[model samples]
Target: MSATEHATCLAIAAARAAADKKAEHLAAIDVSERLGLTDVFLLASGANDRHVHAIVDAVDEAMHRAGAKRRTREGFADAHWVLVDYGDVVVHVLQNEDREFYSLERLWKDCPAIELPADLAHGGSRDGDSLGGRETTAS
Candidate 1:
């Protein structure tokens, strides 16, 4: 089975929250078939600990607002890789280097990605904005 409607909604909310905080490399994997523990895995990365914390806070708040209870939260102290489990959706906020090293996307490559909103498909605003939240232009 794939992600439930509720789970998809939660993931979308979490992704949007992450994006609003200028998170990068946002992706959502449907892990229901691979891992029954959760339906979706939402991944995002930040430049540093402070950025990671901000993304995490936004994700947590959004998920809660979406009616998902906090199941478990880990790695907030270091902010190297914060994992928030909300039963149906799990949000992962990681530092850029750590994210590259761990490569959660590579590990979950077999799963299909959730089609994020157009704005978040590439981690943030698509109208000439970089994934790092900086405006860019054709150079």
Candidate 2:
């Protein structure tokens, strides 16, 4: 089965949160078929530990605001590869080097990617503004 609407919504919010913090290489993978543990995996990378933590905090706040409880959180101390598991959706905020090393996108290449909101589809705004709480250019 594919991811439910709730899971997709959570993933979108998490992605937006990451983008707001200037995260890069944002992507959402539908892992429902491969892993029953969670429906979606939201991956993003930061320039450094500080940026990673900012992205993680933003994602955590956004998810919690949407009423999703964080099931598990890992790698926060190092801020190298923080994983925030929110039952239906898991957000991975990693440093650039760690992201390259792990290469989750390659490992999950078989799974279909979830299309994010037009503005958040890329890691930044089309007009070169920050994402998340920013408006997008109308179609």
Candidate 3:
């Protein structure tokens, strides 16, 4: 599969994993055109530290089950913003405060947003908005 296709699959798999753990504010940013090392950035926010860890765990498990290897993982102990790097895709499982503070969406605003599966897009509500409040329609 192409990079875009692979990124989409990874995004959906990550989203499903996050949803299974009842994670909030799950969104994936397609950074293939913007970044060279990775094709996508999977961003998800959790209610608290525990939830953040759980979300990251779910993402790791899903990616592992897909035969993907992690290049590195960081911020697990703090649980504020756990990052899981999978070569072409980097997953960020963060708490609301940390997510807002970092504001990665704004940093990568220039890149076109990706369209995720309907269920993943509207799965949970966070901070009165739906996962960055960016809507994606499957074409």
Please, what is the TM-score per model? 0.87, 0.86, 0.86
TM-score of decoy 3? 0.86
lDDT of 1 by residue, 36-132 (tens): 7999999888989999999999988888788889989999999999999999898888897887678787678778778777677444434332222
Q: List per-prediction Cα lDDT, in the order shown.
A: 0.81, 0.81, 0.78
Error of 1 at 93 (Å): 0.6
Off by over 4 Å in 2: 121-139
22-137 per-residue lDDT for model 2 (tens digits): 88878788999999899999888888989888899999999989999999999999998999899999888878778767777777878888887767644543334222322222
Q: Write the per-residue lDDT of candidate 3 for residues 22-127, one digit (tens) a residue.
A: 8766667778776788998888878899888888888899999988899999999999988899987898888878877887877877677677766665344445
Rate residue 91 of model 1 by lDDT.
Answer: 88
Clashes of each: 0, 0, 0
lDDT of 1 at 67: 83
